[model samples]
Target: MLSIPTFPETDHQIVRSLASYSDRELVSLHQLHPEQGKFFAALFCRYGAIVHSVVQHAVESQLQADYLFAIAWRQIFGELHRVKLAADPEATNWQNWLIDITGNTIAQIEVPPSAQIRYTLNTAPPPLWCYLERGLDLLPPLSRLIVVMTQSLKWKDRRISAYLQGEGQQIPPDSIPNYLIAGYQQLEAAVPQDIREIYQSGIGKQADALN
Candidate 1:
């Protein structure tokens, strides 16, 4: 039996739903509350690379994509209500508002005439396998699943909590990072390659080789 996910509505529909809220509710929720910023950040953290992909696809160079992605998030937090929001208010359409800003920013900004294109290997190196292993061991057995989901699979904190909760673990929001951090430490402590004894010093050396 295939279980289909139930999305409340499409992203565009979300925007429209949000748009339909009373102006007072929107103003209070978005403008007047300090906690609103935290909620917005949670959304960003949850949807990071996906939202980033939107920027990448909309722009030209990787650097430009990075820059615009950053600016979009910044604008979301800083410029809340500063610009006219979409009349449609669909989250998908609302995203287009940010996309338009990126396009417009590029149109106006000019640098001295230059023509060069270059690609570089990704600068962020993969985390050491040893460190990751150590990190995993640090977590209590029950907590390991959520920790892996967050750190490795890029699942968000709430999703991880839900997963564990479903499995009868009853994880609290505050403890998610603790599991991941401990797992990271375990991986960091992997036995050094050279010092790893395959033939065994704790046991007697192989008889024929020594003879």
Candidate 2:
């Protein structure tokens, strides 16, 4: 029988303390102390969901998604020491780099025929959550960013506009809603008909329940 290793109590405390560190700081810590797994754990806890979302959108089956998710982490772990943060504290280069790595991993995978056929026939949706994620991926980058920030991150329009401006793109607050509307329109058109109907039905049910 094989034995699994467990983290020490002190490592747990280290992970907890590292949660206050920013993404760049966490990456720096991991690079500086490659033996300390807690720093990497903290970084994964912070950004793993985003990575999972990307993998989910790229692959059809949960099994495939899970396999690719682990690969993504391995790739990130192998490459973290090479990452350089920008001088600007608010730069999103670290997050973008992780996303790029996941994209590259996805590109290397060959989708099985059965999954492709099922998707083509619109007989099955990948998963409830994946419908929206796939749709989000189909949108133009700026529109996708706005929608993800608004929907997934629960950021307000003003905040999104401010963040974009800080990143050097000056999107007005009043225009955010229009971008969101356009994003959903693009999403609806990009997804399969059955998936779109299912998503719309869920939204309808939620609205009905709220009334």
Candidate 3:
């Protein structure tokens, strides 16, 4: 049988000490002292934002993100005892494991009503718009959401961020433009060859008009 570690009567110092523990050390400590809330809290405080960001990126509604966050943490705690150390003790497998869990959590959510509506409306878009939609679909979920909101809905980055924040996501305004650029790149790369020229022409015309 594995030996479980015991905590002292005063755990406050232990909690503080956990703050400086390496990720591997933390995992080992948690495995030994599964009953200690401070160890779990320390891990959560260290990686909660990352998990939240991943969930927010994949989900549109705050409610859904909140739900996913809770599920992710619960799963993390439940599985911590089973985590195996990598050959490299310094590797960030723990964080990666959390991100993978977050992705899985997002996958369990139903497609949002807005996304469904957008898909329905685009069923018979014009040829150029058809290609645009296909390209948008090739983007990662978060990037696709950002592109649709920015280009199709004509929402400003600040507004987009605000809307996401209202839904419980914490995406900063500055990050929206980066997501847009990534979405556009995915679109450019994935657009069909036959429609590529037309797409380029349309973008060139738009650029010329702005200049």
Candidate 4:
């Protein structure tokens, strides 16, 4: 009987170096040396973003997505050894296989109602949260801080201005709203079209549910 392979205890440079291997090559190495976690670690590092994207799209909120994402990876790690590359060119990709596994794992997991994200009339879904996070990175530092304080922390314009004033920046409270508008406009432009579509789709779903 084959023993289960151990996962990497921590990410290291040596494991990360295996990222250069092709998907098929990595799978072969993992199958050949199941105990060597570097190969699987390489697979995770290569495809983690896409996996998280898939999970985020399926779940209602970041917290739910994160929970399911970790569970999905655990399931993937367990079954990855049995995966084989198909002969069909389109079907042979590791990404396609991984996505299938992730979807199946998500479908099977029974999350408690309290753990699920409960959307309301005012709440934004995971897509917007993701888009806003990426968009915030592209903004000027002050604008990002202003937007976060205004929207996320629910700070009033005067409070934000006062805070900035204490920090030695003489931003008047009257300019706070303009800064928020400009920051939002920059986020709209800086976020890619595809991500924007996902954000819009999330909004549409919420609207339909609310109505």
Give the top-scoring candidate (TM-score).
2
| Models ranked on lDDT | 4, 2, 3, 1
Q: What's model 2's lDDT at 60? A: 61
Q: Give the Å shift of residue 116 in candidate 3.
A: 19
Per-residue CA lDDT of model 3 for 14-129, tens digit only, reads 44566677787778876886434455655665676677667666566554454455556666766777887674867658778878776776776554543233322112112333
Please report how far candidate 2 places residue 102 from its true position, in Å: 0.7
TM-score of 4: 0.46
- Candidate number with greatest lDDT: 4
Model 4: per-residue Cα lDDT over 82-179, one tens digit each: 88886554556788779999899778986445343343312432333333454567789997788778755668999999999999989899998988
Clashing pairs in 3: 62-167
Candidate 2 local lDDT, 20-43, one digit each (tens):
788888888768864345566667
Q: Give each model's whole-structure lDDT.
A: 0.42, 0.61, 0.58, 0.62
TM-score of 1: 0.30
What order do candidates take by TM-score, descending?
2, 4, 3, 1
